[model samples]
Structure formats: C-alpha cells, structure tokens
Target: MSLHGLEEYLPSLVQFCLSVLRISLPLSLAAIAGFWSERSGTPQVGLEGFLLLGALAGATLVKLTDSMPMGFALTLMIGAAGGMLFYWLACRIAINAILVGLIFNLLIAGIAPFITKLIFGSTGSTPTLDPALRWQFFPYLWAAGILIVSLILFHRTGFGLLVKFAGLKPEVISSAGFSLSTVQMCSLILCGVISTSGGFILSTYLASCYSPMMSAGRGFMALAALIFARWDLPRTFAMAIAFGFFEAAQIYLQSVNSPLPSQFYQALPYLMTLVVLGLRRQGLSEMA
Candidate 1:
C-alpha cells in the first residue's frame, strides 16, 4: 500500500480500535461473571446458555414492545432469577458442576430456537433493532461499571470474602458460620445477571438483533479468559479485551482483499487466543 493509502487507512484503524473496545466490554463482563462463580467454587460452564437466553429474552421483549431499555431491564431480572433457580436446583442435587452447566447450555440452545419459532414464525432470528434506540457508548459505560462493582464486591466486602472462601476453602466458610448455600446462590445470581447483561450488550451493540446461537461460543471464550487470568478480575478484563481485539481484527481482515483463504481468517481469532494464552503462560513461568 502507498503512503497515501496508509494514511487513508489510519482512520479505519482507529475505528477498528473503537470497535474492539465495544466488543471487549461484553467479553470482560462475561469473564468477570466466571470469576465470581469460580471464586465461590461453583464454576458454571453454562454461561453461553445464559447469554443466549438473555439475548433471546431481550430481543423478544423489544419485538413485543417499543422500548429497548425496558426489554434489557426485564432480561437482566429474569436472567438473575433463572440463574438463582438453577443454583438452587444444583444445590439440592448431586450433579457435577461442569455437567450441570452443560445441561443448562443444552436447555437454552433448544429453548431459544423454540421461542424464536413461536414469536417470529421462524427458528432463526428476531428483527433488527431501531438504530435510534442504540447507544454507541452503552457497552463502554457498562464495562467500566461492571469492573468497578466487581472490584468492590470481591476485594472490599465480607460477602466477597465468604464467596471466595466458598471456592478456595469451604471449611473456612463453615468455621465462620456462613452457609455454603447462601454464598453459592449469591455468586450464581451475580454471575447470571452480569453474564446475561453481557449478552444484552452483544445483542444490542454487536449484532443489533438476536439470532439462534448468536453467542457463537463467546461464553466459552470468556471462560478461557477467566482461567487465563487465573481468575483475577483486572487481568481477566485485559485478556478479554485482547481476545476481542483478535476477533475484531478477524473481521477487519475479512473485509480487506487478501490471498489468504477465508477459512484461515475464520480461524484467526481462536488461533490468536491460543497464542496469547501460551505467551502469558510462558511469561508467568519465567517470572516464577
């Protein structure tokens, strides 16, 4: 590319970063949800399901009404409630945490399409949202708030301590006279709300519509980020952003002319994910 062409692309590059930020916000939010759930020793892999469920809920409500914000509000409330209910059931049963989560994912995957069929007369998607109702900065503002609230909840409160204890050392929680049920339930509810909020953000800001499997493995990606960050909120946030950048770059590259096969570009994000995680792991090992 000529210098003049490069100069022209600079503006597009800057715009790309902005898009990365927008995409990263929801991933960070979802990773933080994993952090909360894992800290309570109840890691939920069903986060993908919750996100799809929330997206479905938000889209359905918006389709039925003229208010986008109202749909988002109801989505969060119902997501949290559903999460709490799942936690309650898990506590009463003797299922493996991972298995329980997988079950939830399966359930949501089925239900989302079924509901879509009922509402839209198809098993595919909801209508595109009105552009006027969408805010370009909504994801960024919510991302900041999610990080701040997570910091306060995990680092500065007794509830946070109990939640951490539930994961790190259940005996300590018992010794402190804190019931495991309470901590687990709280963690799951928060996880549900935040993760679903991430879903809402993605549906509104990224896709601008809800569709079957719209989450596209983002929840699992968030979980990978959570583990990559060793369950720390701040580091997980950065890692999630990094993953989002990789995803954004994939989209950008796809739009540009290149001899590379489309399949290569499609695989780029996950490839970069492994590369970034490998680098982080190597660096951590060197430091150790």
Candidate 2:
C-alpha cells in the first residue's frame, strides 16, 4: 500500500487489464454473434466452425497480402458468405437448424486441414504472419465499437425489432409485411460476419499463424455465456469479460511458481464457466 509498492502494482494491474481484454475480445465477439443468431430464432451451434474459418481466412490473407486491414476485410467477406451457406442449409432446406449447425461444424473441422494443405502446402497450419502485421490494442477498440454498434442496431432500429419478432413471434413479423425468412437470413449473415472478428483476432492478434483447432472451444464458451445471460447482449458481454478474467488468471498462474499442477491452472477458466452455468440453472430452478 506504500507509494513505491503502488507504483509497482500499477504496471501489473495495467498489464492484467490488457490481458483480460485480449482474452475476452474473441469470446465477446462470438457471444454477440450467438446473440444475433439465437435472437433471430436460429441456433448457432456451429460458432466454432465460424471461428476456425475466420482464423484460417485471416492468417492466410494476411500472409498472402501482408496487409492487416485487407486480411480483415476478406475475412469478413468470407464470413458473410459462410453465413449465407449456413442459412441455405439450415433454413431453406427441410433439415433442423441445430443439426445443420452441428454438421457444419464437423464439415469445417474435416476440411480445414485440407484447405491449409491446398493453400499453404501444409496440412497443419498457415505460415506465420509478420508480427508487424499483427494488431495489438486496436482490436480492443474494434471489439468495443462492434459491441456499441450492435447494441444500437438491436435496440434502436426497426430491423432489430423485426429480428426479435422473427425469433419470438414469427407471426408478428409476417403481420408487419416483412418476410420472416428474410429477417432470419439477414440476422444469420450478420452473425457470421461478427463472429469472424474473434477468429481474426485469434490469428492476427493473439498469435501469428492459424493453427488447427486454435479456437479450442471458445465458441462454445461464448454460447454458454450468451445462454446464461439469457440472450441479453450487455450481460453476455459482461459474462465474456468474467470468463476472460478467469482465463487471464489461469495464464498468469502458469507463469508463476505454484504448488498446483499446470493442468489445474489451465482448466481454471473452463471450470469457472461450468460453475457459472450451474449457478444460473440453479437460480432459474429456484425461481421456477
């Protein structure tokens, strides 16, 4: 608590905050993507697929073009296209949306290695990108900006209301003279576009290359946060930050000497997620 101690602690505190933001950025984005998808009545269980796709697109584009912005732009375009494909398969066809999402995840997982091999002559990952091409703090701004814009769009626009109706009451949307399927498709496409930023950050900001399975279940974690928050955008964001804090702690604990095994520390964030979800379910049961 002394002045010199405070000065030393200040740097550590700042670094921890930065760490949390870096860790949370992707989860937050994915949660928001899930928000849009589920809010519009489409299950987005394939968020993991989108995250991996983004990571691959971002690392590949940045390595090929050597421009971060260009890489990001192309990644978003790919995401939008992927979203359309998902809508066609899940919505347009007679299959169930959840099953379609699961199948999509499996399909992406199976092809990613082949895609990497075809593009980079490697079955594992894309080549490492230039560190200079990697983003640092700007991604935080981008995440924050996306969150704000999404909030505005969802709460302040008629489009948002239509999307909401598409989820909660399709009959209402139909009564309003808007095509229900159109609203759902648009929401899913936006979901795809937004979710890509998370993977882009994973490859461009957190690491230099796209590795296989780099998403490591963050997509599902984001979904849990979204569901726990009951599809509330702001609350989902907060849950993501909380998860990020646990992940940051896990990383920090690994760096310092500790009596516990490394796996325990590594599992800290996920364990925390399970705990939070359990608590939410318990709370709901009690209320019920």
Candidate 3:
C-alpha cells in the first residue's frame, strides 16, 4: 500500500480500536458470566434480561437518589437478585431458562418505560443529572479490570477446575456430595453482577440515567461475543475488541464518500458477526 493511503487509514484505525474497547469490555464480562453458567451445564440464555434489568436499575436508582455510587451499587445488587430469581425459576420450578430470560426481557422492556414515566414524569428518557453524575469512564476501567481477573480465576484457580467439572459432569459433582444448586446459584449471581456492571457503564458513561432501550441490542451482541470466543475468556476479550473496531469503522465509513449505502455501513458489525460465527461453526463441524 502507498504511504499516503496508510496515513489516511491510521486515524480511522485508532478510532476503531477505542470504540472496540468500549463495546468489548462489557461484552467480554457478560460472556465470562455466561461461561460460568454454561460451564456448569445450566442454560443461560437470559443474560439479556439480566443486562436490561441492570441498566434500568442503575439509571433509575441514580436518578432517584441523586448518588452515582449508590445507583451503581444498587444496580449490581438488583442484577444479582434478578439472576438468582431466574435461576430459582429454572432450577427449582423446572422452567426453561431460555424462556424465563425471554419473559424477563419482555417484562422489563414494558415496565422500564412505565417506571421511568412514573418516576421522572417523562416518557422515552430520564431526567438529566449533573455532569459528574451523568457519564464516567471509571466503570469501564473497572470492567476491564474484572475481565482480567476473571481470566485468571477461570484459568488458574481450583474453583475454576470445579466449574469446569460442574459443566462437563454435573452428575459427577453431585455424586461427590457438592450441592449443585449452590454452585449454580452462585454462578447465576456472579453473572448478574458482572452483566449489570455493563448496564451501569452504559447509563453512567454513555448517558446519565436510562434512555428507552438504551441497551439497544448490546445484550445479544455480548452473547454473540461469547459464541465467537467459544467461551474462552481471553479470546472473547480479543474478539470484543475486534467487534468494536468494526463498529468504529462503520461510523467512519458513514462520514466518507463511498459507493456503499449508509445502511450497508451501519449493518457491518452484525454482518461481520454472522460471517465470523458461520465460519467458526463450519470449522468445528469439519473437524467433527
């Protein structure tokens, strides 16, 4: 490539890397949370619900108390509770976990708007907070730190070994006299807490308080990251960054004069996701 062409692309590439970090941090965390549940052989398709609940709770609580830290703390707690509630329904009531998650997403989607209207006396958006309360990058840093720690815990610790055992052979863990419910419940709570952190990051860093559907399709995207990484934490982290870069590139492309439609540029991330996952699946099947 010509040096001039390379120079032209450098800024776009750098911007893409930053955007990728923003998307990837929460995604990697959510995938790690899902990994824990699935590793224990529990179906956890409800991460989206957990994410929505967390976002709503974080934004709403911050608005109500006018305290950012309290809002974040409560959001994490509520998220854990929400996750545990789903686990109880799935494990104890024998409800399908996927269905339970779907129900929660529907319920939250409806209820959040109503609650926002009730609390803020407005529809579609929440009241704006002070600049300090509105958007903060610290949560992103915290999330990145958590992702690193999770990588260590899952790969290097004895507890990690137990989690692997639980997923691969729940019967074995149960026969060994460990309480499967206990482990599953713990995993669900952890998943909730981490996933909720993403919500807090969104509300606090991107916009203060919740906006309607502010999560957009991030919950599903996070799940996609999980699948793309094959439940591997480090790989998930890297892939999350890759997805972020695609998103950034899409934005950059929209600003430039190209033959492609704007809609095509907008669809790039999801398209890339589908393409990558399809290839990964084919590779696995071929090996099989």
lDDT of 1 by residue, 1-288 (tens): 999999999998899889899878777888888888888888678889888877888877876776877887898898898778678766647477788889989998888878878888877788888888787676788789989998998999999888878887788887888798888988889999998888888787787889889888888888878776777889889888888887777777778865776667446546755676676735552111
Choose 2 or 3, whichever is better by lDDT.
2
Most lDDT-accurate candidate? 2
Backbone clashes, each candidate: 0, 0, 2
Model 3, which residues run further than 4 Å from truth?
1-16, 134-136, 262-288
The lDDT for every candidate, in the order shown, is: 0.81, 0.86, 0.73
Give the true-structure RMSD of model 2.
Answer: 2.8
Regions of model 1 farther than 4 Å from truth: 1-10, 257-288
Considering lDDT, where higher is better, how would the candidates rank from best to worst? 2, 1, 3
**Per-residue C-alpha lDDT of model 2 across residues 1-288, encoded as one tens digit per residue:** 799999989999999998998888888999999899998888789899999989988998988888999989999999999889988988888478888879878988888899899988998789988776667578999899999999999999999999888877879988878898899889989999989888899888988899999998888888878877778899999989988887788778778876777677456556765776676635552211
Candidate 2 lDDT (Cα, 0 to 1): 0.86
Clashing residue pairs in candidate 2 (N, C-alpha, C atoms within 3 angstroms): none
TM-score preference between candidates 1 and 2, better one? 2
Using TM-score, give the best candidate's number.
2
